[model samples]
Target: MIKRFGVSMEPELLDKFDSFIKKYGYKNRSEAIREIIRERLIDETVKEGGGESFGTIVIVYDHEVGDINDRLVDLQHEYTGLIIFTTHIHVDRRNCIENIVVKGKNSEISALAQRLRTIEGVSSVKLLLTNYTYK
Candidate 1:
């Protein structure tokens, strides 16, 4: 069942939302609003789950750190069932960025990303996910 209700907001903000809807090619305000709500629900659901999740982990680090590359690769291999693919790019003379896609329990993926970020050379890390189970 779908329920409809009026939403009050500042005109300025509403204008921007209208522009966003136009840019995103949303058919109507209601459709755009529904998508936003669904996305938020899925996001919150993913965060609340202690079980399975699918997401990408991005990291920036310095390749010059002692054996960091090998260590990183080995660590990912250790979670072979979870790590799907990794894309690597050499940012500069010493810096590098890697995007790793993984699927597994949230705790497992979070722990893996945390461990990688704690490595001596890692400078940044980000995790993005969208996994929800109705059951």
Candidate 2:
């Protein structure tokens, strides 16, 4: 069942929200609001170490850096239980980008991302954590 309700907001706040929805390409306010709620819930759940979540860690680094590739391989092997897959791309003669897909408890995945970020030769690192569900 779907229920409809009314929201009361100041004109300035409402205007800002409308602009946000438009900027994000949300089809309607309801859809945008629902997404916001979902994302908030997921963030809370992940922070609480509630359940398994999926994540991807992207790393850009200089391949020529001393033994970085070897060190990365060793670390990945140590965390084989949490890693789903890894893809490597050569960005240039000296640089490479790696995407590592991981699935496990949020804390574990976060630990792996943190470890990668601390590596000596890593130029950039980002981790996208999600508890997204498909139904």
TM-score of each: 0.80, 0.83
Model 2: C-alpha RMSD to truth?
Answer: 2.4
lDDT of candidate 1 over 26-45, digit per residue (tens): 99999999889877776666
TM-score of 1: 0.80
Lowest lDDT sum, 10 consecutive residues, model 1, at 42-51
> How many residue pairs collide in each prediction?
0, 0
lDDT of 2 at 91: 87
User: Across residues 26-115, which tens digit of lDDT does each residue of candidate 2 receive?
Assistant: 999998888888888877776776767899999999988899999999999999999999999998899999999999988888788889
Best by TM-score: 2
RMSD of candidate 1 to true structure, Å? 2.5
Model 1: lDDT of residue 61: 95
Deviating ranges (above 4 Å) for candidate 1: 132-135
